[model samples]
Target chain A: MTQVIDVYDPSDPRLDDFRDLNSIDRRPDLPSGKGLVIAEGVLVVQRMLASRFEPRGFLGTDRRLGELSDDLERTEAPFYRASAEVMADVIGFHLNRGVLAAAPRPPELSISQVIEGARTIAVLEGVNDHENLGSVFRNAAGLGVDTVVFGLGCADPLYRRAVRVSMGHALLVPYAWANSWPGDIELLRDNGFRVLAMTPNPEAQTLATAMEGLARDRVAILVGAEGPGLHARTMRASDVRVRIPMARGTDSLNVATAAALAFYERARR
Target chain B: MTQVIDVYDPSDPRLDDFRDLNSIDRRPDLPSGKGLVIAEGVLVVQRMLASRFEPRGFLGTDRRLGELSDDLERTEAPFYRASAEVMADVIGFHLNRGVLAAAPRPPELSISQVIEGARTIAVLEGVNDHENLGSVFRNAAGLGVDTVVFGLGCADPLYRRAVRVSMGHALLVPYAWANSWPGDIELLRDNGFRVLAMTPNPEAQTLATAMEGLARDRVAILVGAEGPGLHARTMRASDVRVRIPMARGTDSLNVATAAALAFYERARR
Candidate 1:
């Protein structure tokens, strides 16, 4: 069971991990300057507890501590209980979520390990926005996408904003960054996965038609940045190009939303 | 042509409509304490110009004024051009978008007018988040949803945040608030629309199957708040309860993303 520690000092050394959160994403001391994964709010905190990311410590109000008591029973981390004002002072701002969990970044999984037995996976390229990256994980988790593979130019899914926007699915969903660019996609193809690239081209097959045809085979749905879309090389590497059949004159849907539509179509069949 | 007035003074009264935008959403004199609809950045500003909301005036950097030169050719509104620092001083913050347009709230449209000739509409209940509301509008427009109807507990669609997040689709797509609660749902049914309520119930029909069955009929997709979902009374009033097939042990998708999947499926066939 976790120990509850009462903290009254706003500048306590033990609370360093939670300080100045707005800039915490940059940690030069760390290898990549990416800070530890931070999860905010009670629901997200609970999700963190359940995921593979082990919590280093927790800083939250007594109310949230009480709410998280059941979930914290299995963890050995200390919970720093502080008044809302003291907690806000430590974090450098008022947080309405009232609870938080910090977890060290774990070594990333290999693409082979993530796609070993995966039937449906999402491959993202140039999806650099944190919120969109987070939403992709949430959509993947909810829509039964077995894995998420980050290709070139993707944001850190463990970033605080991404974790929060993902509703902590960034921790729950298995993801791996591509060690190689379009070459990693070839690995997916070799693993019996049919790569389906999502595009806005009207002439391409619709998501419904594409997914229906590939229902019996393992599938990898590839999506790219909203405005630029998939790189020509990436599109060339794919086995098939698929579109969501958007309304006329409407250019495209949000990247994550379009990805969700593709994921949903794959799951439904 | 728009009259370009170069203002060196930061305290110019002509810029009052675009002043202190961070708090401009709260207008005590307005019915809902919401201020005039605001459009920021170049694309959204152009969209606002093309929308039903007429810009009374604009405050922008000269660069943005030059970019908007073509769009301003048809308008007589004054462009209050200012330096970036002066623009920031008047807006009480850094205006990264470099431009803004303020339009007063027009008269509310009747529900009948919004739903008229609509084949697919989204009826929102208790979805009070401005960002989520905006995303729904953007998704609706991109996915071919004809109109939006707000039933109860919805935020003001014209709020500045909603306008910006909707990518200015809040101005393009038509929406109307229901004067009657669930009773307004009958109005849709009377117009030959099949109201499909979205839920997380495992027993409910999948969105794909449900939407496929209703492809030929007018459809109104009903969504509620993220946490509580549709009220029991509201769900009871719906014609069919449909659910997005989710992976086991996962929570529901974001309100806007879930709505997008449904809208995409409806348009897919």
Candidate 2:
């Protein structure tokens, strides 16, 4: 059973892992900093406990402790119980969710490791926004995408905001950063994955048509940043180009939204 | 041609419509308050110009003025050109978009007005989050949804954040608040529309199957809030309850994303 330690001092050294969360220089989640993966809220905390990112400790109110008492039985990590006031003073904000869990980020998976046994995967380029990255993971997890491979310019998926926005699916989804931009395209091909790049070009085949033809194949969907879509070299390297059939006079959909449509279309059967 | 007045002072009374934008109580876009509509960035401002929310005035840097000069020819609203520093003082933050447009709230359109010639519409319930509401409008605009009808517990679509997040489609896409609750669902049926409610129930028919049958009919895709979805009474009123095919152990998709899938499926033909 996990030990419960009641903490009254807002400045206790033991709470350092959960402190100054919004501080730009001191936030523990920064990859260059402590690299801690922080999970906020009850649902996300529960998800963190289930993910590979094992919890180092927990800081939450007594009410939250009782709520999580059943799940806490599985972890040996200590729980620091504090009043909401003390927690607000320690973490630099009043958290409505009433609970938090901090975990050290585990080693990242390789492209080959994440794609093993995967039938559908999402390859992202320049999705630098943490929220967008989080949404993509949530969509991928819910829509049957087995893995995620990051191309160039993607943001860190383990960032605290990303994890929180992903409803903690960022911790559960298997993902990897590609060492070689377009070169990794050949690696996926070697593994029998057909790469389809998502574009807004009206001349490109619609997503429905592209996805329908590849229903029997191991498919990889490549999505770029919202405005400056896939780089020319990356576009040329893909096996096929696909477009979402959009209404006239509108720009492309949000990158995450576009990815969700592709994932849904691929999984429709 | 629109008048361009060079202003060096940040406290000018003429710029009051664009002042203290981040102040909760003083924000000009508050419905019960100023009831003003605000559009940020050059793209959204240009969209506001083309929308029905006639601009009362604009406050932006000289660079944005040059970018918008061609679009300004259609309106007589004065553009208050100031330095970035002065504009920042007036707006309480340094807006990277470098431009802002303020317009008085126009009269509300009735359900009859928005649905007159519409073939596909989205009906929202308890979607009070401004960003989600905005995203629904953005997705609807891009997916051929002609109108939007609000059921209950919805936030003001004209809220500044909603307009910005919607890419100013809140101003372009016509929407109306239903004077009745699910009662207006009958109004839609009377006008030859089939209502489909998005739910996460496995027992519900999949979106593609439901949409395939409704392709030849006028459709109204009904979506509820994320957690506590459509009320039981509201669900009963819907013509069909449809769900997105999701992987096990996952919850429903975001309200806006689910709406997008329905809209996309309906327009896929």
Candidate 3:
């Protein structure tokens, strides 16, 4: 069971991991990243506990602590109970979520390991927005996309906002960054996966028609950033180019929403 | 042609409509609301010009003036051109989008007016988040959802953030609020529309199966807030309860994304 520690001091050294988090979360690539994954809210903390992430410690109001008591039983981490005022002073701002859990990021899963026995995966390129990345994971998990593969210019899925926005699906859904982007497209192909690139080209096959044809085969749905879609090279490398069949004269949908459509089509089977 | 008035004063009264917009936009429901709609950036300003909303005036830098000259040719409103610094001072922050257009809220469109000749429409209930509402508009425009109806507990779609987030689609796409909640759903039914409510209930027919059966019918996709979906009464009033086939153990998709999936399925024709 987790140890309960009463913390009154806002500047306590033990609370350093959760201190002034907005700036820290903004710069995960910084030298002093602390390499920690933070989960906010009682529900997300519970998801962290159920996932492979091991919470190093927790700081939250008594209310949230009580809500998470059942989930905390399996962890040996200390639960630092603090008043909301003290917690806000420590974290540099008020958090409405009432609870926070910090866990060190484990070594990333290898593409081979994450894709093992996976039937449907989402491959993202230049999807650098954290909210979109988080939404992709949420959509993926909700629509049965088995894995998420990041190619180029993708933000850290473990970034604080990403994890929070994903409702902790970022921690639960297995993902891996590509060592070689467009080249790795072949790796998926070699693994018996048909890489379907998402495009806005009217001539491209609609998601419905494409997914229906590939229903019996393993599929990798590739989506790029909203404005500048899949790179020319990336599109050429894909097995099929698929579109959402947008209305005439309308711009493309948000990247995450578009990805959800692709995932829903794949899951419709 | 728009008359270009060069303004150098930051405290000028002409700029009052664009003053402290962040705070004003935060509480559009406040009694002090100026009863005006704001369009930011070059693209949104253009959309407002093309939309039913008529800009009373424009505030922009000379650079944006040059960009919008073509669109401004259609309007006689004065373009208050100012330097970026003066523009920032008037707006109480640096205006990155480089342009603003303020339009008085016109009379609300009637349900019959918006749903005229519509094949697909989105009826929202309890979706109070401005971003979600904006996304629904953008998705609706992109995926051919012809009109939007607000049933109950929805936020003001003309709030500045909603206008900006929708990429001005809030101005382009037609929407009407339900003066009488679930009762107003009948307005759609009387117009030969099949109302399909989006639910997470596993027993509900999947979007594919439901949409496929109603291909020849005008469809109204009904969505509620993320957590507390369509009220039991609203669901009972719906012609058909439809669900996106979500993966096991996952929650519902974001309200806008789910709406997008329904729109995509309906537009896949």
Question: Which candidate leads in DockQ?
Answer: 3
The sequence of per-residue lDDT tens digits that candidate 1 reaches over residues A205-232 is 9888888899899999999999999999
lDDT by residue for model 2 (B1-269), tens: 78999999889989988888885224434565644889999999999988898998998989999999999999999999999999989989899999998888788999999999999999999999999999999999999999999999998899888998899999999999999998999999999999999999999999989988888899999999999999999999999999999997789788899899899999997
Q: Give DockQ: model 1.
A: 0.83
Query: For model 1 chain A, where is the 10-residue window of minimal lDDT?
Result: A244-253
Stretches of model 2 off by over 4 angstroms after superposition: A24-34, B24-32
Q: Where is model 1 more than 4 Å wrong at Cα? A: A30-32, B29-33
> How does chain B score by TM in each prediction?
0.98, 0.97, 0.96
TM-score per candidate, chains pooled: 0.95, 0.97, 0.96
Tens digit of lDDT per residue, candidate 3, span A1-269? 99999999999999988999886565456454545889999989999999999999999999999999899999999999999999999999999998999887787888988899999999999999999999999999999988999999899899898998898999998998888979988999999999999999989998889998998999999999998999999999999999888787587889999999999888888
- TM-score (chain B) of candidate 2: 0.97
Which residue runs of candidate 3 sit more than 4 Å off their true CA positions? A26-35, B26-35
> What lDDT does the true structure give each of the candidates?
0.92, 0.91, 0.91
Q: Please, what are the lDDT tens digits per residue for candidate 1 over residues B1-269? A: 89989998988888888888888988887775669889999999999989899998898989999899999987888999899999989999997999999888888899899988899999999999999999999999999999999988999898889988899999999999998999999989999999999999989998888998998999999999999999999999999999988898798899999999889889887
- Candidate 1 clashing pairs? none
- Using lDDT as the measure, which candidate wins? 1
